[model samples]
Target: MEPGTVRPGGRTARVRAAVLEAAGDVLAEQGFAHLDLAEVARRAEVGKTTLYRRWGTVTALVTDLLEDMAEQSVPRTETGALLGDLTANARLVRRTLTDARQGPLFKAVIAAATCDERTAAALRRFYEVRIEEWEPCARQAVERGEIPAGTDTREVIRAVSAPLYYRFLLDGGLLDDEAAVRAAGAACAAAKAGAFTTDTARPRSSDR
Candidate 1:
């Protein structure tokens, strides 16, 4: 089955998941430069021909891997307050970024994406989906007057994770629950202060 053609439901989904899991393991073990499609096939116990036929290039494989990661990412939950929702988002992001396997895999994928357009596009799509997933929490906050109207939801979501990523990727700092709480609190304060609010704000429905 093609990398992007597997329908979610039965044996095909399971096979695809197995392949992605195997690929992720390889990626984490040895960076993208060392990723071997044949090794992935062997580890997944799938046909090498299938892997080749589906993901023809390293970029394609990484792209599909990123898509799979995004698909497996946790969805946002409504916890009745903006801080709670953001705290959930922050903790989830922190956990993923600090995870032993996922952290290395993500670093490899991000490095590959920087040089490969297909990988870059896939990375963008992955972030887009995540941002959209969290946008509703920001919108709900606006509806409840917990945040300023016309706040940029996507930016707010990005802010919540930016510091965590920065520390993990750049400073090599520990990503703990305290860091998650700090991130959420900072993002919440920024949102309330209109840091994420739009300059070209139009009247919100609640204002009408």
Candidate 2:
């Protein structure tokens, strides 16, 4: 099919969806260095001209993928209890990090971000979007008196995933249910203890 021909539905959207899926597959299996436009187009069964005309560069493609991921990500679940909310968040992270296909894709994207400024910025935005999604859980906890009024909601949300990412990216340790539960429990305890509050004391520089 020609790029100029309009489809019944959203032709541009369908092309973008196909291209991104192919890009993700290449990134997961072959990493960023192997993700060329011509190859992605071939894999996606799309025209190379279409991909080049649309994305122009691999960085743009990756950035667009991240944006799409952020948009399509699951919404947060409310479990009434802060621990329950946190547990749900932690488990979701753990599951993604452990997924056979998704795990490799995430690892590849993170590795690429280290060397590419555009990718790094996109990665940061992706995390910020994810954090924003879950931060409301902490806010709700504050309203319920489960946590302090001045709590840093974003920080609390980060706390739930930090340990899992640490293991997934660095430690190479197990990301089991136990780890997920522990992460949530620790974050919840810290929130309850005012560790995430804006007024939480900081040690003097000399004391460090």
Candidate 3:
């Protein structure tokens, strides 16, 4: 336990916060291939040994960052109506993906996940946590009879976001308030139609 390398008490948390912030900056600016732990240590003003001991590799650092992001995500908006709640979820996704800082950071992580197995798992877990966070809104809708009794709550939540993500990362389409509302409306309509009903899921035809 070297004095400078080993943080005491509250400094451990502070060191993590600083290191994560520096790592995010590197990812947002140049993506993962360019993420050097030494550079991150310099930028974070943390000791290089400490950085190495704590995170070891860029992948580990990014995984921890994703975990923190999932833990700190905004709480679900409870509107008491399926459409209203879904619309809120849609708008929130649009807003986050459009943020100057978050947009690039997310794009970087997504690209990294495409080729890196560990990153892919971390990214998957991040979305799973987020979807679960907002899953309750759809469950409430089910209880209210706004949607079918067997509606897949998490799927309904994912439906509200899938389009916005496509526009942001694939189609390069506009993600405005109108688009959010429309997306939410379509998902809400589909939910009411049993599109996401667990018991009513369509059995797959074997051939592709």
Candidate 4:
């Protein structure tokens, strides 16, 4: 390599990593409303000018953070069986939502997305990536004749995580491991019953 080649994961990468970590800590502890760039710089031990020059705005930084999170997210587990696969997925989601840092960080991003269009788009993309990663589980189930032929695999994947999100975001219900199993079981049952079949899916507003 040439001199000052900035080898893989060198200063630039380290700075970005530190900054993003600091940002996540701020979001998890204080929420989006309090995510100040200067504070983030201070926490990361990076210069404020570097943060401004790199990210420019809070929304941009947040969007990048979300993208990084999606990229770094754990890969889906393959269990051959639909229920088993979904249960693994559900457990993963539960673990993330119940984690000390990740839990609050997700809540902060979700809250920000509710009112910020850019954040909402980023959040949607994040879930899209996650769903795509897990969609194969449902597809494999179809190949195994575990679900109907025309089943909407995406819906099956979404179903497995929806209840867990509801508990995490709205219901205040117990978000235990059993809850994850139950969520997976319910989605699996629905899939096996053809509830998520394309033919049974609700029509779009334009179709109506």
Candidate 5:
């Protein structure tokens, strides 16, 4: 690399981050319907040609933003128990979903994803990353004998956030620490009862 030129990985990562930050600001201020590539490039301080070359379409730009958001999220922590780890996960998710700016930004991105295939794929990838981040906590619980050995780590992690996302996006319920605790408790009880132990099986109806 030249003295002033960034390495490929470093430059690409920085440019992507800058673009996503600009995109988030644009979405928050003007909504997705008003998003413009030229404006985003101006805000990010990168050339419009560069932005267009890197992300071919508006959908691609939004997709990249979602991927960046997922990559930037904090990882889960181990607390030596399933419930504790789940509770922490819930709190972290709740905090993000309930934030004034982030909440609206996410709503815009999700709405855009619903209509754009590329954006939808990116959204799914984002969820996959988050699921992977928390899967280890559930895996650890199983290894420690706190939950069934065959528990579905992905499902358990998903369960912890499903209700939280539903409440935020659909029901308009309050997203708070208390809600996080309730979600964690529900996921933990279901996990303990082997509701998430089998592949190709739905969570036990009793868990609902």
Candidate 6:
């Protein structure tokens, strides 16, 4: 377990939950620049000493918070078809990015990662976990012959969410249902067209 992370059980669970909640709230509302440890402790009603002992620093607290978020994240949707599954995944990403609290929270974290190495690493790990959870959908598609063999499942999953993230982080476009559908459709089309086929699907070095 990382620093500031603990097995949640009974009182320890409650304390961890409160602390992380406070930290997330702070990040969403005030951004990372204002996420003071003392403030988080006060908001959580946890002792300053306890916060210091457990989290040690704001970066560690944020890291643990992200880990907790990933653990608590919703499981992948199974829709039996590649397009259906990708649509579900895209919609989930859209909802999260447009959520009342989660949107700003993610934006703040992304901004923090731009300048903080530890925060950036934690953010990357968070996405990696999410992508792994969703990658199986593409693999299943291959088995169903909906996509070609050697399709890069990870890339397919990433592509589904990439447009949504770009709009959320750069274009500031609305993440509406139509946008979600469009993103999923485009990725599915590309995958079917062999856009994400791995190099293994091509001729081997010896064959060339």
Best by lDDT: 6
Candidate 2 per-residue lDDT, tens place, 1-208, comes to 2222222248777888898899999998998888888999999899998987778889888888888788788889899999999999999999888988778989999999999998899899999999999999999999999997788889999999999999999998889999999999999999998888774454345766
Candidate with better lDDT, 1 vs 4: 4
- lDDT of candidates 1 onward, in order: 0.87, 0.88, 0.86, 0.91, 0.85, 0.93
- Per-model tally of clashing residue pairs: 0, 0, 0, 0, 0, 0
Off by over 4 Å in 6: 203-208
Q: lDDT of candidate 1 vs native?
A: 0.87
Off by over 4 Å in 1: 1-9, 202-208
Best by TM-score: 6
Q: Give the runs in model 3 whose Cα sits over 4 Å from its true position.
A: 1-9, 199-208
Over 1-208, each residue of candidate 3 has an lDDT whose tens digit, in order, gives 2222233468788888888888889988888889899999999998999878877778888888888788788888998798989999998888888888888999999999999998999999999998998999999998998887877899999999999999989997898999899999999999998799875453345621
Residue 124 of model 5, lDDT score: 92
Task: Give me the runs in candidate 4 sitting further than 4 Å from their true place.
Answer: 1-9, 200-208
lDDT-best of 1 and 2: 2
TM-score for all models, in order of appearance: 0.91, 0.91, 0.90, 0.91, 0.87, 0.95
Local error of candidate 1 at residue 96 (angstroms): 0.4
Better of 3 and 5 by TM-score: 3
User: In model 3, how large is the Cα lDDT of residue 135?
Assistant: 92
RMSD of 4: 5.6
lDDT of 1 by residue, 69-123 (tens): 8878898989999999999999999889878999998898888877878878998
Estimate the overall C-alpha local distance difference test score of candidate 3. Answer: 0.86
- Ranking 3 against 4 by lDDT, winner: 4
lDDT of 2: 0.88
Candidate 5: 10-residue stretch with minimal lDDT? 1-10
Per-residue CA lDDT of model 6 for 151-202, tens digit only, reads 9899999999999999988897878999999999999999998889977695
